[model samples]
Target: MGMSAGYELSRRGLKTLLIDAFDPPHPNGSHHGEPRLIRHAYSGGPAYVKLALRADELWRELEEATGEKLLERAGVLNIADPDVYSYAGRFQDAADHGVRIEDLDADQIRFRWPDVRIPDHYRAMFEPNAGYLYSEKCVAAYKKLALHSGASLLPNTFVKRIQAERSFVSVFTNTEHFIANHVILSAGAWFKTLEPFVRLPIRSVRKVVGWFEPSVSSFEAGTFPGFTFASSLGSYYGFPDIAGAGVKIGRHETGEEWQPGEDLVPFGAYSEDEGDLRKALEAYMPDAAGKLLKSAVCKYEHTPDDHFIIDTHPEHSNVILAGGFSGHGFKFASVVGEILANQIELGHWGRDVGLFSAARFSPISP
Candidate 1:
């Protein structure tokens, strides 16, 4: 995600410096998972839908610049009961934002998707433009472009401390220190340690993604699109069988509590979370959830609400804070990169960001 920001800054002729504790496109960070759902009509809010629309445009621009096929046009399936969030709230977002959406009943879904066997009472919202973004490749593409644009990138370098002042900010790594006129803190999970200097209400929590084999061979790229099932339990979303990795599935709900650099990253299947998830798959999508292949664990830096915090520091305008994406921030990384660059250079965003401000949660002045 930060790769795009660094690339955009470099492309805009800024002397950009990109630092990451982990290497770019490495499996250590949240960008590991191959595909993430990109839906225009958001269940989160109407403002997010607008942001997503702009993001879609930026993503296409990035693809053209990098000459890599980063985004897939497989569409998105949001399944839920008529009373659930996908049906009531997300449908409202589509209607309000004037995005194209198709409502599908159970019979319609079976006729269209063929493989998906939804319950009679359940329904689905189909956004034809929604699809998956190739995450690691996107990061790689941005990093490549950023390096070519003369940006200094330091990988496997830990940011030990940061000291912000009135005029400039001093950042200290494990081995080196960088003093810059402005600083943009886009650290994913290790964002809280710098909270003393730049306070933002963010928490890092553990999350996992599971891959399951389908009972039938209908889980191909064209046969099945990425889907999210809204249940009384929570939102469970999954992608199609891209690159024969079976189906990648994960819940939007919070996982176990975790502190950065302290929690154990799980790869093998376990009983605690997998048991319940498997039961859900068996009940809702038996053909697609029959075989549990493996699971990979990651961390999410979350706010009290699932919205992003993409504003500059209230106390110091020189320092920008952009952590707390929860987990849905990857899809918007293409445009967010530009937003971060704009915020750092202009000290204000040209886009509408009223819903993403940190001040919305409290009576703090920006």
Candidate 2:
């Protein structure tokens, strides 16, 4: 979110600086995984249909601007047993938003993607336009553009303190303190440790994703679409094999509570890191449920409700807070960045952000 916002802020000739505790595209936050799913026609918590569509536009624009293969047009499939809340919500959402979804029965799904071995009662919604963004490359593309647009970046500079005053914001880093006319604190899990801002409603948790070796070539990209499956067991999301990288899958919910400043326990540190994803695969996607190849651990800063926090600071209007993305935020990075930039530069966002307001939680002290 910070990187995309930085690109927008800087691209428009605003004096901008992007500060990162670790060099960006680095494996610290949620953006580390190779591919982050970018599907629409929503449901789960809030309505993100329009926001997601606009993000699709911006992603295409970024692809044109950078000439980098950022997003894959492999499409996305949402499958679950009949009458599932979240899965059914996607159908209603698609209908309401005029988003077209190709309905598929379990037999069709199995036929289309031979590696899937779902039950006969399962159903699916296929969004041909939906797929994923090469997350690290997206960040790297934004970084290059932001720098070319004359933005200063302070990589490896950990921000120790931030004071959002009535007029301007003062940011204290490990080396020096700098005051700015405005600030966008797009800190992820690290938002919890920012002293004065700690009172805000966001909790950090650790999550893991893994690449599993599949038994067959039928699971390769183009042959299969990115998919999210929900069952009585749990929810899981995955990508088809790309260039022999294997099927990358992750759990949608549940992770150990994590404190921001501590060193992240590595991916394979826990048995469940691989076991959890393996469980989901064994049940619904048995064909691609081969041996685990590799894994990665990521952090999510979630609000009480899993919706995002993209509103202004309750205390300082000049300070924009963009965290609490929960789990499903990477896809919105492009639009969220623009929204943050608009909130600062234009003083108003064209779209309604009522759902992302922090006021939903109990008030925090100034």
Compare the candidates by lDDT and give the number of the best one.
2
Q: Which stretches of candidate 2 lie over 4 Å from their true place?
A: 44-46, 83-86
Question: lDDT of candidate 2?
Answer: 0.86
Highest TM-score model number: 2
lDDT (10s digit) by residue, model 1, range 246-362: 887888785777776785657454565676567667777777776677777887778888888887777778877777888888998988888888877776677887778877765
lDDT of 2 by residue, 1-366 (tens): 999999999988899999999999898888987898998777753359989988989999999999999999899988888755336657777777777789899899988877677889898889998999999999999999999999999999988988877998999987899989999988888886676753678889999999988888888998888999888867889999999889999988788899987888888788888888998888877878898888888988888889888888787888888888998899999999999899878999777889888788877544
> Each prediction's TM-score against the native?
0.94, 0.96
Give model 1's clash tally. 0
- Go through the candidates in order and give each one's C-alpha lDDT: 0.81, 0.86
